[model samples]
Target: MQYTGASIRKTAAHFNIPSFKAVSQWERIYYEQGKDALFKEQRGRTSKMGTKRPKKPKTNIETNEDLLAQVQRLRMENEYLKKLNALIQKRERSEKSTK
Candidate 1:
């Protein structure tokens, strides 16, 4: 890998590489082995702790109290809708009778 050409040209000459320049380039990358001599750059695969499990967030009793109040508000809204529906039904019945 460091000074790959001189040995590769000799090996290629023995096996009969077509051109001296081609053997020189091949030896520069890989002297004896054809494909394995190329150095692959792999500097991006290290773990950076950015994807690790995070600490649990803090939860107070006030947050629970806020959720309970929201539930109570929804329940009151459901009751109001039921009363409004009954009033509409009664009005429709009275109008039908008058007609």
Candidate 2:
């Protein structure tokens, strides 16, 4: 089951399992962590700490329309913020020139 260097040579000699490195990896895992660790159970990128899971998409038609309107409102807010930031920078530069 657990294949070491000695085991790899023995297995290769007797049974012809070609990858010694792969066999050695299996051996190390089995010896150190046991069999359950070898199985691939978890899938996809793990969520970061303190970050909430993304909300599921709304299936209801009314809810989807509401969300779309909210998204447009948020986009307008972002554009307003950008223009405000540019105005503030222009003011800062003007003040610096005056001084």
- Tell me how many clashing residue pairs each candidate has: 0, 0
lDDT of 1 by residue, 29-93 (tens): 56465576655543566776677688787665468788999999999999999999999999999
lDDT of each: 0.73, 0.78
Worst 10 residues of 2 by lDDT: 1-10
- Tens digits of lDDT, candidate 2, 1-99: 433435576766565778777667776777798888778555677877787889998776577788999999999999999999999999999999999
List the candidates' TM-scores in order.
0.44, 0.38
Give the lowest summed-lDDT range of ten residues in model 1. 1-10
RMSD of 2: 15.5
Best by TM-score: 1
Off by over 4 Å in 1: 1-62
